[model samples]
Target: MAINLAILGATGAVGQELLRLLEARALPLGELRLLASPRSAGRQLQFRGETRTVQAVSPESFEGIDVAIFSAGGGTSREWAPIAASKGACVIDNSSAWRMDPEVPLVVPECNLEAGRARPKGIIANPNCSTIQMVVALKPLHDAAGVKRVVVATYQAISGAGARAIEAFQEQCRAAANGEAVDPGPLKGQLAQNLLMHWSVDEASGYQEEELKMVHETRKILGDESIQVSPTAVRVPVLHAHSESLTIELGRPMDAAEARTLLAAAPGITLVDDFAAGAYPTPLTAAGTDPVYVGRIREDVGNPGGLQMWVVSDNLRKGAALNAVQIAEGLFA
Candidate 1:
């Protein structure tokens, strides 16, 4: 049955990707309503082939909608997700608002598809960009060799911040080309020619929020509190894809060849680990794809039972909107 659907924050990057992927991914679609801030009211965005006007979201906006996919900020989601849920629409939120909530399900379909059934709050939370890609790559290995600990560092793309930040990055790059001082928009410094040790600061924790998201969300989705995670989230000059360097300690030694074989057969994983051929997943190559690309597979000699790998994916796709759509479409699957 074709049901009514709404894309909250339709003007934002993730929301816009949801619009494109609604038909590109060929997920179940019905009457598509675009909802955004009042500033975006009357703005028309092309979907599939038709033009749809984006509306300002209200409590009543979800009345006839069967599903609401929200990519608006956390505050917007905190205020409106319940309102949408109370209206009878199943919400798949792309914000952090409801992720760790006891009532909501934070899901990564490949790792915890069954958790989708536990949404008493009528809202499903999408995992963070870094967590989504990391877990997708980690799941296969974790199942094969009991993963004991994970130490990862992320090279996050600016798009994970937002579309405006991406524009600011481009502007900075242009200025750099002209030998001029670059301007930082939402970021504290120019991300064009620099790297930041921290992405989103969480002063109390003394760690980047992205790193914390990876640690907490990994444990939640994996359902393994024993899986110790230490992460350092860094922001690079890349425009779109999020990449991670992982060191996974297993209960027993698993050689690189065996790890490669397992990842090769894992769902949603594309293995391109041919160091001899000089081929591997890079942010430039992974910018607009679905699969979480895994490579740089090697055995950590220091710990015989450990393996090291690199994971990359389009943060907008698997990390946010596409993961939300995957969970939403699985309702029909």
Candidate 2:
């Protein structure tokens, strides 16, 4: 059944990717609506070989919308998601607003597409971008060997911050090359040649909000509250595709070759593991791609029974827009 759909925050980075995926993917489509803030109204964007003008979203904009995908900031989602849901749209949100909400299901289609069917509030929360890639890589392992703990350190891309952050990083790169002062516009500090742990801080736990999201969201999506996740999220000097080094402890001992075989067969995963030949996934290679690239699979020698691997994916694609689209596809199509 073809359905009517709307994109909230349609001019932003993830929103733009959503448009591209809608054009590229096979989603039964009836009507497509592009929406944004009042200031962005009248802007023209190309879709399905047609020009669609961005409209300043109003209550009536969602009147007949079957699904509303939001990539705006948290405040916009908190304010508008429910409104859209009330107007008969299944709201798939790409912000932190409803992620931890008990009433809302935080979903990654590969890990838990079934959780999306019982949306009491007519809203499904997209898991954090970092969380989305990690869980997708690990879920198969968890199903096969029962994952116990995960210690992850992320090398995230600046594009995860926003389009403005990408522009800022480029400017900082030019300045660094010229030995001029680098100004971090939305990034807060020099990111041209430097790494940062700059997501919002939680005063009590002292963990960046990004790290905390991995810990909790991983548990929620995997349906295992006892699974421990220690995460360190660092913003790296990359343009797209977020990468992570994960050390996983499982219930039963699983060797590298076994883990490799499992990941090779997992859905939404691309295995490029042959480290002896110097093949592994990287941000540059993963840019503009969909699959979560998994490589460098090996046994954790220190932990004896644990495994270690590297994961990378286009944060804007699988991490945000594509995941939301997949949810709507599974639910409606």
Top-scoring candidate (lDDT): 2
Off by over 4 Å in 1: none
lDDT of 1 by residue, 292-321 (tens): 999999999778868999999999999998
Worst 10 residues of 2 by lDDT: 162-171
| Tens digits of lDDT, candidate 2, 192-215 | 879998899999999999999999
lDDT of 2: 0.94
The lDDT for every candidate, in the order shown, is: 0.88, 0.94
